[model samples]
Target: MSRKTDPLIVRRLRGEERVLEVGIGDRTGVAARLVDAGIDVRATDVRPVAAPEGVRFRVEDVTAVDEPDAFHRVDTVYALNCPAELHRPIRDLAAAVGATFRFTTLGYEAPSIPVERETLGGGDTPRLTLYTATTRDGTPRGSR
Candidate 1:
């Protein structure tokens, strides 16, 4: 199947030093595309995952007791088709790590955290709406 999550994320995150792709459940190409763009990508899921070429995979529960180490180095943290329940936790993780946090929600679920919406599509590119978390500070909510 084609990865609905692609180039847009790659497009938006250009020039980042490193990034974390959270809840990469079956949407592995998101990280893959980020990698092709020369961004360092590390993806995580609660369970183990098969990483794409040039992408690093980790088993992580963002809501777990210990923080995921990937946070320390990444400049951005994002998820695609993230469920409503995870919006806050993931955004909080990004906040704690001083990373810019963003996500796209499942169609029916309203965002549970503050966000700025962006529409990503026009022509052959599939239309996708993505949410970038807005933190309390001037920075993106997740970033310090």
Candidate 2:
């Protein structure tokens, strides 16, 4: 994805609030882009990885996260191209922290969390599809 598109996607997922990028692999490009755009964001994964300057990094396994405050600091949680198996855990984590969840799945795979669909870009621009999970009250977070 282009650097310009990265921030747009983050904004679409998180609006202007702090976001936690879960399952961030070796690449911190998205996190870096968000930081450059003046958004408060962090990246995490099951294994340790180096983050770009101004971006925070943490080692977290969503499937086994037991910390009560695991995601309390962020307003939204998201992962790009997240695996199908991690969707439920991510949703639970978001709920635990009272934050919203968002993710993009590989290909045509659907998200495990109930979501509202959004499409970014048009015509000449590459279109990206994202799923934004709702709170238990059924309000779409970040849409506000």
Candidate 3:
């Protein structure tokens, strides 16, 4: 099967030292593509999977990585799942790791039937949100 996840992991990796993927899933296809494109990559998640060639696998909780300074050595970070309140934490992690580019694809919130209206900010509208952040700061400090 053709894997659609490869593009997200490879696009911004041209001149980076290495790229890290937060969720590996069945998306080894992306890892394979990254290797083919000459981008060094590491894959990490709570679960373990045999990684494809040229992709290093790390089994650790994103929130529990002890050495936050290690992140400053990478060029890119990818997070596909939208983990609610932890979004900012992930962004901080990417920054800590020295990732100049970060990309995330969050699941679209289910559309509401009536669509609640807001008196302020803006009127009721369909919302699609994806979380992506890039920063020169490669460390988790203060707030994102």
Query: Which candidate has the top score in lDDT?
Result: 1
**What is the C-alpha local distance difference test score of each model?**
0.79, 0.75, 0.56
Q: Cα lDDT of model 3 overall?
A: 0.56
Model 2: worst 10 consecutive residues (lDDT sum): 1-10
Which residue pairs show backbone clashes in model 3?
Answer: 71-97, 71-98, 72-97, 72-98, 95-138, 95-139, 96-138, 96-139
Q: Which stretches of candidate 2 lie above 4 Å from their native place? A: 1-7, 70-72, 135-138, 141-144
User: Candidate 1's error at 137, in angstroms?
Assistant: 6.8
Candidate 3: stretches off by over 4 Å: 69-72, 109-131, 134-144
Q: Against the true structure, what is every candidate's RMSD?
A: 2.3, 2.7, 9.1
TM-score of each: 0.87, 0.84, 0.65
Report how far residue 131 has shifted in candidate 2, in Å.
0.3
lDDT of 1 by residue, 1-144 (tens): 136547777788887879998888776877877788888998889988788988888887888725645444588888888899999888878877778887888888888988888888768878888888995553467444
Better of 2 and 3 by TM-score: 2
At residue 86, what lDDT does model 3 achieve? Answer: 47
